[model samples]
Target: MRLIRGMAGAVLLAGTGLAVHPAHAQQPGFHRHDVLQHDLSVPGREVVQVRVDFDPGAVSVKHSHPGEEIAYVLEGTLEYEIEGKPPVTLQAGQGLFIPAGANHVARNVGKGKASELATYVVRKGRPIFVVAD
Candidate 1:
């Protein structure tokens, strides 16, 4: 629990402006579990954010990260793919980091819903660098 709180504080200090309430801190709700969260905003530098969600089949598009990303599989499985590497299968309680300029994608590869959390430290105004080519 202390680790989760520390992570949450780091996220808040790294943001430009985010409206979060203590009442909703670390609780499971609709769409996401939100075990913790942090915004990524650095003045004249980079932006960093962390998101924790609880659900199955939640996914993002195939894209690249302009900066670096660290993702932790808190409670479920996820199918992860990078542009030039063999796809990776992440199970519950696992985590991986994607380096800057690396193209990748992720999806819930499990049969049912899965929950996971991700923290990204990225260049400001640029997050996912998706190319259709």
Candidate 2:
């Protein structure tokens, strides 16, 4: 049902990361689902992928990840506000990169539900979702 290979290659080109603050991990109609996990050739490194869905008008609040993330839009539009950088808005089939430890918020800017394929290259055994403000 899946192809595990090449995920690391995707991560190599994917460095942007984003997360939802703990308080809003389950905000109304907002959801995150782990898609898969694969161990990287680098010792103590791993790749984790998740599918995050946002309802219209839903906002992630400021948050961060334990490592780099490459968020590719799967549907709808999302606006990303990352610390120290201008806010970026992405549409379906587009993507945005968020650096590790960067505080950011991902909001559903479209009238319909928005979602992303958030893939991360992170340290083994570390939580991908980290608290942020």
Judged by TM-score, which candidate is best?
2
Writing each residue's lDDT as its tens digit, candidate 1 over 10-101 gives: 33223323322223323222133333334435564444444544345655544455677788886667878877889899898888888887
Residue 3 displacement in candidate 1 (angstroms): 41
Over 1-69, each residue of candidate 2 has an lDDT whose tens digit, in order, gives 122222321222222233222222244557767577888999998888878788899876455677898
lDDT of 2 at 93: 99
Cα-lDDT of candidate 1: 0.56
Weakest ten-residue segment in model 1 by summed lDDT = 21-30
Residue 35, candidate 2: Cα error in Å is 1.2
Task: Give the count of colliding residue pairs in each prediction.
Answer: 4, 4
| Ten contiguous residues minimizing lDDT sum, candidate 2 | 1-10
